[model samples]
Target: MARSTILIADNSCMIRKGLRSILQNLENSEVIQLIDNKEDVCGIVHKRKPDILIINPDMLPGDCLDVKRELFNENKLSLILLSNRKNLKNDLKADGYINYMDGQNTILDMMQEILNKNNKSSFPNKNSETISSREKNILKHIALGLTNKEIADQLFISIHTVVTHRKNITQKLGIKSVSGLTVYAILHNLISMDEVK
Candidate 1:
């Protein structure tokens, strides 16, 4: 598995240090770049090509929207905007947002969430095959100890439909047993450990 590289582009010393501290603790994390220069972030991202780029929209040089558009156009690196405000504007249109008002835990959680979604090896299929919403709900239902009949009833589908979905889920996930599926659901945050009982 290739190590994941993360770049932090915030001019603020405090925010940079905080992000670095939080990111270094993640597994498979390789390089965490803390940008001291407040230049064109998109150019830096194009040059470095880090797995993820966390930047403050307010700190971007020139038009923030233009930079965001340029970064979006590049499409190689994932963009995560960091904001000190509680309510973020809809204009920046970043892939992810971390609000400073939500505190340190929120930053860490958001970063981890983005990394999880973007990390290829995080899933059974190397994150190649996207799990449909219906499949995810079915997986959750199976993990919660619901039988095919019960699931069908809850989902308003036929028992045969539930069985077919179960077969497809097993084939896609490579998890045959209900226990294995339960563990997968828990690890992927589809269901919580507390909800297992």
Candidate 2:
């Protein structure tokens, strides 16, 4: 099996240290670099050509979508944008997003899901289907063990709509049980594992 190269770009030393500590546990993971600038991201990515690139959304130049497109046009490199704000979730342009607050195990699972894949093309792309913000909100509630009626009330939607959204989320992500969806939510940064019940 080939070893994985991961590049982490964050302005905070603490954040970089935390992620490196978690990611280093993966067997055969190698050549990890913690960078502190947005301008250097493209240069490093071009030079190192890491298998996976983890970066803070705030550290990216201009709109993240544009930066993702320009810097990650190669399908072999998977990009993950990390953020703590719920509202920062954008359309599924990058491979995915990770909440910086996730537990160590959840972070490991998310990265392994990308790295252990047989082919890089299996990673999420611009054309891949994504869960809507409303669906993501409902998913968070469901993961917290809320009833469909309770979720509907909380989101100001009908119970039937809540069911429909759940079904859509299931179909898009191919995850059925509440636990599976909870893991999915954590992996996608729709909700942190700490927020799950």
Candidate 3:
């Protein structure tokens, strides 16, 4: 089997380097791209077309959610958006927010999980008024502080879709701000205090 290509996007060179090393060590993984410039992530994804894209939520510029969708447009690349552990249960990040008790280990684990899924392109159905699986996946990233672009890359959805999820989530829950959604997620058991705090 061909080694899986990995893309790293972050504003910090040191962080990107560290992630690059980790991915390099994986048996089927290779760091095919590294992006420290926010302006370049979208363009890079379009050009390189890696199998998996790992991004830091805070690193991307402009409505982070928008970036998520942009990357998902032409490919089925899996995403690994680093996020705080508290985010899994709550909030409405544009997308690409994944909670990790241990950011590094969690990322590796998530990658393994995706591989287990064999890069299946099936996402949560889009019908119904309640939060769909795709929305839930993105919300998990938001609570973790992932930006829109990060979420898009992670979920393989469009930035527009990530934004749509955020809007729909807020409308259904009657919440807007991140803090408010975080709190609602916690209070309603959508997420736990441990995850929120």
* lDDT by residue (tens digit), candidate 3, 1-197: 35678788877677778767665546666788788887887788888888777777665555344555655766877766754546632433432444434566665676667654543344343324677676666677787677889989988889999998898888766778888877766665666678754
> Is 2 or 3 the stronger prediction by TM-score?
2
Ranking by TM-score: 2, 1, 3
> What residue runs in model 1 are displaced by over 4 Å at the alpha carbon?
64-67, 121-197
On TM-score, the candidate that comes out on top is 2
Best by the lDDT measure: 2
Model 3 residue 153 lDDT score: 92
Clash count for each candidate, listed in order shown: 0, 0, 18
The TM-score that candidate 1 achieves is 0.55
Candidate 1 vs candidate 2, lDDT winner? 2
Instruction: Write down the lDDT of every candidate, Cα atoms only.
Output: 0.78, 0.78, 0.68
Model 2 CA deviation exceeding 4 Å by range:
64-66, 118-197
Give the total clashing residue pairs for model 1.
Answer: 0
Pitting candidate 1 against candidate 2, the one with the higher TM-score is 2
Q: Quick one: ranking by lDDT, best first? A: 2, 1, 3
lDDT of 2 by residue, 74-173 (tens): 7478788887867555543667678877888888888878776623554344224888787888888888889999988888889999989888788888
